[model samples]
Target chain A: MTSLTPMVAELVDYYDDGEAARHFQFRLLDQQQWPPPEPGQFFMLSVPGAGEIPLTFTQLPDQNQHWWALVRRMGSVTSALFRLEPGAILGARGPFGRGWPRPGSDQTPVLLIAGGCGLAPLVSQAERLLEMNLGPVALIYGARSPEARVLGRERDRWQHKLALFEVIEQSPGQTARRTPLDALPDVLAHWGHEPGATFMCGPEAMMTALSQRLIERGIPPSSIWLSLERRMHCATGTCGHCYLSHRYVCQSGPTFGWPELELLMQQPVTTQTPPLLSC
Target chain B: MIHYRLAELAELTRHLGRTRQVWQRSGAKEWCQADASNPPPLEAGRSVQSAKGFFFAEQEHIFEFDGRYFRETLPKPAPFALIGVSSCDLVAIAYQDQFFASDPHYQARRQQALLVGLECTVPCEHGFCPTVDAGPAARPGTSDLVLHPVGNGWLLTVTSEQGRKSLQGLNLTTAPEAMKQQRQAQLADCERQFPDDQHIRDGVQALNAGTVNASTWQQMGVQCLSCSGCTSLCPTCSCYGVQDQSADQTITRRRFWDSCLYDGFQREASQHNPSDDAGARVYRFWYHKFSDDFRKDFGRYGCVGCGRCEATCPGVIGIHSVMKRISQHD
Candidate 1:
């Protein structure tokens, strides 16, 4: 019988990352049956008293069965997760959902777009590209402010190797609220190459706007990928909570090509409705 | 497939009740445990509540975690028989069987239950089962035994090996071969008696053609109180939410019936709600019930035309009302 019961994972360590986010490392008690998770795949973390919440793997599990994720203290489950001390036990089940496919090529430039805490799912992919010595790879990470930015450590390491653009809504502590779109022109100009594939995660409006712009710039919807977040209970796809139309976002994707995502969102209501800000 | 002269349904029920619990449809919406000697009348009416609860319980503890280990909780229900279930409900049970085929907890309860489907001889107030391919007569293979009322007794068609085995001790005479044609005639008459549901057919078309306006849905959505009444009463709605209750370090995870019409049903911990708009949630609920994409997976539309939702919904978004509104839009 397939079970929702999760194997115990103890928190090894954690440190404050962004404004209300923490970088957490955990070591699973049992790894004998764990299928190696691809970057961008997520897991369900159970806070003993509070319920379960889905989190992506910012860092894949290593030899010691230690994996890491960048978690924002968003609600009950994450709040409970943040309250626990190092070595505190929690439950986890996953490596669920479709992850990012391999980049087209190291020689083919890849563009990365992220908004605020949305960077978590794409951070590992960026790091892997950097490690591969892939050139012309660019990242545009938009945040409310410098302090509101995340993965500061990962950014610092990639600065010399990456075509990085840290676009903030409020620049130098305070400025007119700008957006990633305001910086898209300059970022693309500097990269000076049409990206072969674009990976994105962020606010719904930001992702949709960027995807449209990319498609207008000659990128096929098939080559543009984005990670979507939805409410999920049973990651096994039995529970219908995470439906992106008929498809379960927890099963078929958290990551999807723009074309596939567009097709899934073809329900009449979605098109008629204006974009609403999504967390 | 076999025939039997059921001299008395009570006699057959009595023999089966010896080893298994027998629950027969009672009143308009309950299945009361029956006394073998005096079985309740098996009227050809719909049950607002179905046999769904017998397998996929409304609330259940799925698992428990106690510091060191997590243990799953699977129900072990005793062998039971559902007597005089209407055809629409039996079809819903068949649909759930395929959906929860991999779910062990559902299987444990399902495997022990023998379904006895009762064919409708006349249309019930809210039912239009024939329109959705569910029936006045039970569809073949949906139940273990199908009962068609004939003369002063019943014609029991044994559809499964389990049904045949359970009837071994019943003192039934062989039914006349002409009874089969008589059974067919009664079912056809019942089907013809169902009021025309042209709106339902047109609404299905309008829905699949994507012609219904959001404004119409919003109007209907406004009437919905999110009381979860329709979903609660719906036989095929299988969405659920999980909760964790902890005491003395033991965390027990419980799952309860959840409705997609509720705003929080698809709300994430990040406070992002996929169906934040009531209209969207309303549309999604109907979409799940009537969408052709869903039909491909379940072999039929999610709705069995039982009209439980129509009977229970306090709002105008019940199947009939919504279908009329949407089809009118077309």
Candidate 2:
């Protein structure tokens, strides 16, 4: 999806929260050249002054307005993208990476776990699953708070197809609030195990804990899939920055299953002193 | 093939230096004096760095992009002949050739280089060239010319057409008995210094075949600072990042070396970190060297056992030692 294409669309709507922001709609400038994006695919959006960044597709599988990117203003690339107006030129190439599993009766019930921005891809997957009429899907999402939660406008769209649970960590803007990871037990119990495949995306600590909990609940290792993020210099595998044990996060995966638990959970942590994040 | 006296050899090295700075491969800046016990004036030991610095320079520009224009350019390279190169380094160069030469951008820069090989009379203690079939000495196609120490003089074998031209300017001697004797002694000395390479291959094999847990890798992590020193010193590691520089209208693209050990290397715009911890990052280094892709490309292992990384590493976490430890584990 990273081929250079001019995408111009109506700036339909824009919403901004401090940490992340969402663009409701974007027009694909070159619709004729726009290639179809897989459900789990992503696009590399290029901003002139800043640089290029990878964002997951959020608008439904084959919906209108070309594509959508959920940008979190944490880095230089996204911060630059956030400042662009509706008609501004945003260069994009992608819709890359392996997407969600094809809807099939061959598999059991499906469990989707998302935390914070982790919800981006799952939302895309949920929309596609409904179009295919594949169900009994459950969407389990955890966030710091309800106000910080995103896609409230799209709530009605999800409620009809998937059983949705939004676990908010804090009590409205309270300083002393719990994290969504702290409420894992309730989320797990609410899902009620019936041997279904699971897809999880979010922070590493949260994903690790969630996978462990699901494993204890008797879910098969092969049944759970995980999307991971590593530092990436070149979204192509050549840079080796995003390289994991035996995989390249940008190449082999941003996704894996329970069978790879050891590669993630068992590997030794690097001792290189990490630089503190400067504000 | 031709022969040259010690004085003639020294002059050739001086001439090569004019093309580019000729630091002896793995040689320290200082020279070793001749002792009564060791007659020939030998340069101290081999340098702890590889020839990688020449081909894939520590810092390189691929392209530059500014507001409007970008011109693609490579670093200005003066034709150079890297002498005293080990078989291991040559093999490592072979691996790099597969990488850069495969791409037209890299091939352009590589075409400007030359190789001068030297046979070792005394191999470095840490070097394990024979195990990977990289050396006790230079391979056939490794260099344009090979210099074998012969008695009081040297046996210079020209391996390429370019080497023959380079030798045209030199005053050389016919092969003599004393030179033959010196060559035999050098070969014998290398065998005595390091007899077999099976140990290195065995250790690497063990690490690959074993299923050691994360604790082992984590334990090794205590000493690692992720300084990127190890990666920088490794000859076969070819990972790099591309940056663009542009001004006014023309744009240029450039590539710089990158290490997997850095945290920022994998940090995404979303602030999600996949291998944020040390264990996952360290695992990446070992896995790449032993990965299926590296093996398929090189026909064996990616590491040539030069030991430069082990020597320069502040952490003292030798890849050879780690492979051995993993192999010993159940």
Candidate 3:
């Protein structure tokens, strides 16, 4: 079942994907294809000396046993992870939490929104939808600037397959493109399809704003899903660090329907103005 | 279940210790390993800390990683008996039992320990067990054995098979069925003696109804120092964080008790914290204690009404204080 002890995943290779971020490919040394992770499922990565951090699977380990994660050099664990060599041994435990719900039988266009490195969680989903040849699937991604963008190679490939819109906050150095929100209307317009389901992950504000905008554009709150990031010590729900109301974000989510997440975020109300998704 | 009337409480303690390590009150608010030699009095007040540490150690090694493989470090505790655990503490143990049912490390220690519950003849200073249904007497199925102070002796009730077999050789006399009624009467009187807890009722209702103003929670958060005393003392609070340290090229991971009140408990490595607001933490703490959402999952509220948080909180945001504020706001 759930083991606190992580299985060793040797670093097969890695490459810089974005500013301070790397696309790490590791081979599951001990585990085989016993557990196949769905899109948006996360794993706990243990850096021998620096401790553990939760990362989403950009590429899940299949029969070949190659697992990929786009990890940003944020704190101690990632710092130690960045210091490792090609053959360095590390620890990984998971394929945990409720992953993104699969596309249903309904043939409604699926829209995905991601900000900065948040695109990692939705990569496989986009690929899955493309392979399935479902109604038009599109991804609207935003970054602070071109340099801050991640998964450059994936974006390049996705552009040919799906309706991909990349936006930047930087104005002068590059021709300014519409923000993710501004690009949303056009994406819907081009396809003449209102997304049956919208999946998003990013800064809290953007996700919240996007959910509200989706709702305004006549999408049900239940149809919008978001992946959350919280400090997770145990992906198994024993550690209450990832608690959101009665639910532990690590177990009940990492991905939650907008309505479900809104309920959790509203409890233990902290502000009279509005509930800040960051808190 | 079998019942026996015994003139000496020491005889039961001596019998239990013969087979397992005995832990009883060592000081007014402390419990430690002790034999039947110096048995501490079963006082009315609960210890400042609960017996949670017996099963869930405050700090323990989880796993060790050498350059190659990860090995789990499960605890192998000696068989032990916790003597004279209060009703509320027993309730809290049951709550933890359900929460850690799947955790191998917690189960490893918990399976080796026997719980002997003590019935409170009178209410403790900060207890509101009746309010939370945790009790003035041990709730059935929460303990292996139960002890009730009868008129000149003790009424020993065997609640579990473990309690029945542990005393195989001891000679005892069966109690009349009336003793059960007598015990109930004693508990009812004890419950009646508890102070008016309308505030607790009101506060819990307000919380579940989502009527308490956000600013009220914010004010309570302002007073909290994030000292973590309340959580440490709370019998059912079970949050943990893991740490890794290196020695001789091997990395050892130790899991230690963590507090949700700490700002960084939910702070991600990206510095994106969903609970960065102190008010959110304060509310989450009480919401866990009093929220109906948790009640549906745990079958009861997380707080067992031990009131350990009330005694340990330096800030006035203890159960009594927080409840008063919430109830008074309307």
Highest-lDDT candidate? 1
Docking tier of model 2: it is incorrect
Better of 2 and 3 by TM-score: 3
**Which residue pairs come into collision in candidate 3?**
none
Model 2 lDDT, residue B164, Cα: 74
TM-score, every prediction: 0.96, 0.74, 0.96
Q: Count the backbone clashes (under 3 Å) in each candidate.
A: 0, 50, 0
Q: Chain B TM per candidate, please?
A: 0.97, 0.82, 0.96
- Candidate 2 fnat reads 0.35
Candidate 1 stretches greater than 4 Å from native: A30-32, A131-135, A270-279
Model 3 per-residue lDDT at B143? 93
Greater-DockQ candidate between 2 and 3: 3
Off by over 4 Å in 3: A31-33, A173-178, A271-279, B177-181
Q: Write the per-residue lDDT of candidate 3 for residues A147-175, one digit (tens) a residue.
A: 88999998888877878877776756666
The alpha-carbon lDDT assigned to residue A110 of candidate 2 equals 80
TM-score of 1: 0.96
Worst 10 residues of 3 chain A by lDDT: A270-279
- Candidate 1 clash pair list: none
Ten residues in a row with the worst lDDT in model 1 chain A?
Answer: A270-279
* lDDT by residue (tens digit), candidate 2, B59-160: 665444443323345456656566666667777887788655544445555667667676777767677776666776677676777777665556776778
